[model samples]
Target: MSSSNSQKEILTLIRDVSTEKSQGERRVVNLKRQIEELQSELESVNAELEDAKRLKECTEQDLKGCEVELAMNESSIQTLEGRIALLQGEVSTIGSDLEALKVSEDICFVAGGFRFMCMLIKCLCFEIAWTCWFINLCEHAFRMKNGLCDDFIGKMFDLNAMIRKFHQSVDSASYEAFSSKAVLQNVHTENAHTKQVEEGKKDLERELAQIISDTEKMEHEFLLEQNLHKQVRSSP
Candidate 1:
């Protein structure tokens, strides 16, 4: 009866051993699936990071182009201002010449009078031409200033907004990468811990299997001894 009870216990142990092995296998499979998911997330985050970098580079290029254009516009404004100054000087010189001719007319001899009349006519013509030229210069200066002002204002606004956008994008991309990296690190740490636990469980299972094998061998020896005793008693 004790032998039968011992046999029953051994069978129960075997069933428990099998169940533990299956559970271990299932745990390993679950861990592997988790690792795969984490890896996929990491790859997706990296791709997004690369795309953000490319966009930032493009924005930088655009800003550089805008700066060059602004420089050119400033140069044009300077040139126009210089031309306006020169036109003002020419108008002043014409006014001085006209004043001298008036003085000459008052001091007249007949030849001097004739020469003075011709000079006056010439001055009048020059004044008309100078007035037209001065008006044109003023118009051109106004146009150049207005155009440059508008262009500078518009370009500056665009550049500033773009720069801010680029910075925001860079910041956002960095933040995303940092967050992903942190998650990856956490997943890796969990995997490492899980692997260690799995290794420990395997060791424990191996030891348990050895113990069960030894117990089975001992149980077989006990059964053999019991059968021999029974045979001896029956033969007597």
Candidate 2:
């Protein structure tokens, strides 16, 4: 009976060793599967990170472009402001010149001045008319060249044009008023010059008549002296 129990014990030890080896094989297989799963998850995460990096670079480039556009817009605004200031200065200078022209009412000619007055008035009218037409053309050209037909651009031009038109109208009215005043003064000067010329012509005619009368009187006195000498010689 003791020999039989030892053999049974040895058989039980062999069976237990076979079962543990089988469980160890299953654990190794599970570990390998888990490693493969972890490796796949790591690869997926790395791919996602690379895609995010590419998106970040694209976003940065877009932002840089936006900044550049903003800078360009700011520079354009500054240039427009400078142009407006220069235009204002030009308007002011034109206004002053118009005022000076309005105040200059002195007549330049005094004697024999009818033809002269006609010529002067003709020249002044021609110059003023030409200047007004030229200014109108210049304003129109500026509007066209500056894109002033657009609604937004037209707004700037409208403000400037309105101011210019208002001042120009005032100046034109002043010029007209001065012209009226000058007309009366010029007429008076011309009349005075005409009267003086007529009087001088009459004086010249009177002097010529007196010289002819004196010469006729001298010829009559010499003829009377010659007749007295002839009578004296006949008596001898």
- TM-score of every candidate relative to the true structure: 0.38, 0.39
Tens digits of lDDT, candidate 1, 1-236: 99999999999999999999999999999999999999999999999999999999998997787667556555654554555455555545545554553343221232233334455565567557766765775566567755576655565467557656655655554454335433443453355434433444454456555655555555555555555545544652
As a whole number from 0 to 100, the lDDT of residue 47 in candidate 1 is: 97
Evaluate model 1: give its TM-score: 0.38
What 10-residue stretch in candidate 1 is worst by lDDT?
Answer: 105-114
Deviation (Å) of 160 in candidate 2: 48
lDDT of 2 by residue, 24-119 (tens): 999999999999999999999999999999999988897786567556545554554555455555545545544553343332122224334444
Best-fitting candidate, measured by TM-score?
A: 2
Error of model 2, residue 66, in angstroms? 3.1
